[model samples]
Target: MALDIYPAIDLKEGRAVRLFKGDMQSATIYGEALEFAKMFEDMGAKWLHIVDLDGAFAGIPQNLKCIEEILRTTHLQIQIGGGIRDEERIKLYVDMGVSRIILGSIATKNWEFVKTMARSYPVAVGIDARNGKVATQGWAKESDMYSGALAEKFVGSAVQAIICTDINRDGALSGINISFTQDIASRSGIYTIASGGFASSGELKILDENPYISGVIIGKAFYEGKINLKEAFALFEK
Candidate 1:
């Protein structure tokens, strides 16, 4: 199967940034968010993964204007998450031309609501895990629920995908937690996208060989020039 690539553009205070281990204080601004969206589009990316970092921490959509600008300007299919806690906000993003909306913190608190939304829209559950435990409220609060256990809840639902991130490896550029990601994929029985700590084409090849992993979110590695977006995309082309 051809592995899908989602070039990421995490927004912080209206600027594109990368955070270390989901730390708000460790944000390294890349540039204007819109520019990064365009750059990803130029690199032959079919999808763009965007996160409202400010919104994730605030529990409210804070970077509406920035998000709107990218939606209006870029043609890449967008999947966005962060601070989307209500049906109204979900509707708002859908109306704004977003292809999909990811529910992070809310998935841990009210997965039933997530299942309901999945019936009507393209919804993906963002399971950001730290040490096998699920973390919510922007990775600040660790829940007692195990990551695989949470994923098992949506075993047979309308939910489109499970975006599982290993908090410890995120933004560190060490390596991707393939075993952890595969575990989620096995439990959820849903399309799973791996996020965090993707540093090279080697990792991409590893994911391509796994049938359960549908895609990956490229963050710090892409920003730090550790991976070439075009070259990574070319791997599955052969």
Candidate 2:
């Protein structure tokens, strides 16, 4: 299978950001959010992942206009998450040309809703976890259920992929926990996209060779200049 790279553009108050270990207060702003989209597209990114951090906590999407701008200006295939709770919000984003909508809080709170969504629309589930337990509400709350068990629930359904992220490694500029990601992909028998703590071009090549890993959502690495965007595209795209 081919490995896709989703250059992440996490928005907070209309600016792009990267938070340390999923902490809401630990955001490090990095200029305009739209610029990131343009830069990623210029560097040959095939897909983009956007998160509405403010909306994730406020129980509603806060960066709709900013997200809309990115969509309007760029031809990048986009998948968005964070505070996506209701069907109306889903319709709003889909109608605006989003390729896929991710189910996060709803994946844990209302599993039946996720299953129903998988049946109808192109969908993915954000399986953000810390030390084996799934984290919800933008990683502010922890759940008793493990991430793998949650992935198993979507088996044989329309759920397209599991965006598995390890909160402990998130934005730490450290390498990703490949074993944790591997476990989820193997156990669930689903296309697993690894997120959090991804750094360097070496890791990109490694992810590409792994048959189970379908993609990786990289943020801090790209913004920090640890992974050259052009080099990443050449390696993963090849």
Candidate 3:
């Protein structure tokens, strides 16, 4: 049950912005994407979670400029999500040396596309939900699908992991939705990455014991100076 914490570098309008509940309009740019990524790397984080905010909302590929900058700069294992809907987009990221390509919107909408991607790439499935119902189209829309039901779709494939994010808790700095996250992992045997509403290391300490939980992605807490990545790494090192 080793826990891996991925400091998030979410790019919105080519700058780093941690959005509340995945809201794009209510965001504040904090720094350049490359500099931010470097800071996370400096903290001894071996993996980076990078998201293209615009690409996620527009349903089109954006932020390749910043992504390329990250690829050129860091040797860390990079897992990229957002606007990755088709085979070409998946190929583009893999060709650029992205370690894992996350399929979100397309995985919920097009079964054939998801199947094709699992067959062709090192892909991951992201289930972003609000109150247990899945959301898509950049978290602007919700669906009737439960997170567990969705995980059943990737039973056997190249789907390396499932990133389950509680949309209501994202960027809120309230608390990690542990019960919901743990429930999904318990029911589904796939490796799970917890996302959204992680406000402190104490919350992570609780999660560290869960063998089903493979990783957690930190965004607002990391930006707000709540969770110290360096200390987190040190704690895990011990």
Estimate, for each residue in 33-72, the C-alpha lDDT of model 1 and write its tens digit.
8998888878788789999888888998889998888878
C-alpha lDDT of candidate 2 relative to the true structure: 0.89
Q: What is the TM-score ranking, best to worst?
A: 1, 2, 3
Rank ordering of all candidates by lDDT, starting from the highest = 1, 2, 3
lDDT of 3 by residue, 129-212 (tens): 998888998899888887777877777656788899999999998887887787777765778899999998888878898777
* Candidate that beats the other on lDDT, 1 or 3, i.e. the better one: 1
Instruction: List residue ranges in candidate 3 displaced over 4 A.
Output: none
Tens digits of per-residue lDDT for model 2 on 1-238? Answer: 2678899989999999999999988999999999989999999997999999998888788999999999999999999998999888888889999999998989988888988987878888999999999999889999999988888787777788889999999999788889889988888788899999998877877888888898999999988989888777876675
- After TM-score superposition, the amount by which residue 34's alpha carbon in candidate 2 deviates from its true location, in angstroms, is 0.5
lDDT of each: 0.90, 0.89, 0.85
- Return the lDDT, model 2, position 189: 84
TM-score, candidate 2, is: 0.97
CA RMSD of each candidate after superposition: 1.2, 1.2, 1.4
Q: With candidate 3 superimposed using the best TM-score fit, by how many Å does residue 25's alpha carbon deviate from the native? A: 1.4
Using lDDT as the measure, name the better of candidate 2 and candidate 3: 2
